[model samples]
Target: MSRRYCLVGNSHLAAPKLAWEGVRAEYPAVRAQFYGATRKQLGELEVKNGAFGAHLRPTSKKVSRAVKRVSGGSDKLKPGSFDAVILFSLGFNFHQAEAIYRTHRTLDFNGSATAEHLVSADCFRAALRSLLEDSLAVKLVRQIRQISDVTIMLSLQPYPSEAILKDGWKGWTTLKAEGDVGLLQETYISAAADIAEAERFDVIYQPVDTLNSEGFTKQDFCENARRLDLAAGDVHPVKNYTHMNADYGERVLQQLFAADAP
Candidate 1:
């Protein structure tokens, strides 16, 4: 019987396509599957691409819908339906916390507020916690456990390119600003810890360390830079950066699968 693996989550998950393309080029015998939120269908295999632009809102029902689609709408697959499941989610929803507060004026002490006042520290923290409970972290854990014998890999996207930052800062400064970055890092670490404590599943850590190797920091990316005219300055990494993410995914997959091989 052929083994199957499923890759799911937001745009960060999309990076694996580049990596998979590389893998296919290097090892044509390997058969794998990828499901992301962007373009649907990979070669002859149909991909349930669920990635949408700024669509990972904590309160959005799409999170659950994505999970359901992957699970075959609760129609039980044969045991070991997926040999592995890789998740590249979290950062976008985390970043969205700030966008949410800014749009809702959640931090406005008075009804009238400036853009600076919209991103207050307290509001950011509140947004982070609210997003955590309602969106990415826990939802991912539950989804992974449902698929039997599946080796689950939870990896985060690299920090956005220096171009994504609003001002010239590495990241936001208010409690909310710092928390947006801090909490997402904490959540990834804590979620890995929680999963390890609870089960035998594999959880891979893809931190900012690799991006740092390029001498890029959150501040560098956020500071003044030419907007990526392609997508109107959305935080998605450009092709070169996406290749970096793909390399990280390839290394993580090799380590995990090699270790598991008998």
Candidate 2:
């Protein structure tokens, strides 16, 4: 019998969904389901009898649509119903990462010891703690833990796609990406793992082969990614923020499966 898995998240669930559609045939004995809503509607999830269920009707059509978009709107996940529950790219992704990028200067914990490095580590730990304790990520995990005893995986969102590295993106975050993006990514993942472990959940990081030298996702994996180029006006046009194609998502799913295996 195939093992059924429930994956829950926001828009970031796009990659995993895309990948599964393209590669489900390869893993004949594994089935996956998804439950997603816009970030704002996440709090709308209701806990019932120790299981997470989507309410019959949500306040907005968009949230209602999101609930049905992945797995039909009524697939209530109960404890031990599936082999795994993977939370993809929620909570401590860019919101927490960008904070460090803007503050920490060239201080690498992976490098030789230095006072500056220690300070950076300290600052990063505090930020990580805040995100885990106060951010939506932890709250969601808390909800899931109460409802399910299956293996839980908290996967951080992928780093800014290569599109952010292009000249078209004039955002301040892109500037920070150019300098020490790898270190920033590492800091985010390390801190996330620390808190995830404390909660008895597993953490997943991006595979090295998918990353470029600076730690941004490689362009090949970001086929649909878009960015705004220089225009006559200082206006930065809205570009598609897609960061993963089916291939990349497939890689992520494969990794998650590998970790799920004994």
Candidate 3:
């Protein structure tokens, strides 16, 4: 029997949805349906009992249309019907995590702690983990479990763009090792996984091979990338977008399916 997957996300579903068309060609037995809305448009929808329910208002026509279209005219998703649920870009934003880490001078010792303590990876790891555990993204995974017990995976995009790979001296280089922030990245991912695991949810990160030594995404996989151009004199040095093309999406899905294999 063909396995059915429900693709749910905001704008992140686009490339994956496009890639799924080709993926279906290779794995013809698999089928998928997508439900998506931009953040600006997602406010009018709510999860109710394993499906999306409408928040009908005078301004909710667009959201209503999306739900109806994706749910096959049903007011909510059909329960217990899908074989799996793959939510893309619905987890912690590593970009934001990096920004927060940079903005806060978290290592000030006040002459109490030793210099080595200030640079310990554990401190940075814990800080990032705590931040991720409380994010709405982590909470969403829990909420989704409240409605469905099917295989639910919390998908994170590749850690960050390749452009930021070498930008180690913006502010917090002392806390990192070999200019690699991967330890901190894993901390956030691990914290998110811990939350999801409690609810029987799984979290998957970009394949390790897709990342460069600095733990940023590889440029070859970023075919659809664009530069991050900040204002004059601003310090945003990253030159790539995290959103990828269908080719990269295919690779991601292939890895996901391989992992799901027994």
Candidate 4:
């Protein structure tokens, strides 16, 4: 019996065509699918590439809407549908806001308010609390629990690399100065903990923090002295970084399927 997997999220969650191609090579027996909003095309397997690109920060309203779309569109799936669903989101909003503030020294909307002034620890927590209440999280949690024999995995995006940060130093520095770094980490850790405690689902924490252990700090990832266009100095992780995520996914699937065995 072949296993089924579905991935849902924003453009950041969208694996480059090469990543999926690599997945196919590694897991020839498993059927993979994608549901997101990216220009890249999946050559085969099933896909619902309708998700829009946005910053999926801790308290994003878009997360709820995207989850709702997934639940409501369940009927579109084949009779048996998905055995496992992977959600890859929640980091964009914080990073984007940081980037904006760093460059302009002000908010994208109100130049008067700087990014440093806008994102406080309290504000980050409040936004995250609101985001967790959105319909999508509720729906997905309900669906996962209600549906028999389905596994739901909520995985966090890898922390931004120093290589990436180097590419966008000004914005990154402003964000750090505003103390958003600690706030962002706290939000993700707290949210993931809350979700895991509340639900019987699996929460896989990538070894993103370990990157720093390996001497790859934010500076290394963010700096773009290489001046390469491919290295778009933004919060989004580069495709190469996906290797860690993909490995995490593979290990997770193996555990889920092994446990499912009769």
Which ten residues in a row are the worst by lDDT in model 3? 227-236
Tens-digit lDDT string for candidate 4 (81-156): 6677665543322343334334333222233365345554455455555455342433344444543345766555
The C-alpha RMSD of each candidate to the native structure, in angstroms, is 10.4, 6.3, 6.6, 10.7
- Tens-place lDDT digits, model 2, residues 1-262: 6677888776667677767788889989998878766566765665565224421234556565557755665435453667877887666575565554444544553322322234556766786678656666567777777766678787777766666647465443454535555566666667777788777788877777787776667777777522111111222233434456567778889998887875
Top-TM-score candidate index: 2
Worst 10 residues of 4 by lDDT: 38-47
In angstroms, give how far residue 158 of model 4 lies from its true place.
3.0
Write down the TM-score for model 2: 0.78
lDDT of each: 0.43, 0.64, 0.57, 0.43
What's the C-alpha lDDT at position 170 in model 3?
43
CA shift at 23, candidate 2, in angstroms?
1.3
Q: How does model 1 score by TM-score? A: 0.49
Return the TM-score for each candidate structure.
0.49, 0.78, 0.72, 0.49
What lDDT does model 2 reach?
A: 0.64
Model 1 residue 175 lDDT score = 26
Over 194-261, each residue of candidate 1 has an lDDT whose tens digit, in order, gives: 44456554555544444453223433332222211213343343433222345555655565455445
- Candidate 3 lDDT over 1-262, as tens digits, reads 6777776665555557667777788877777766655544544445654223321211377666655554445434432467777777754667555655553423432221323234445565566666666654555455556566768776776665564435654433443432437544655576667666765767777877778777767766666532111111222223445666566677777877776664
Give the Å error, residue 61, model 2. 8.0
Clash list (residue pairs), candidate 3: none
**Backbone clashes per model, in order?**
17, 0, 0, 21
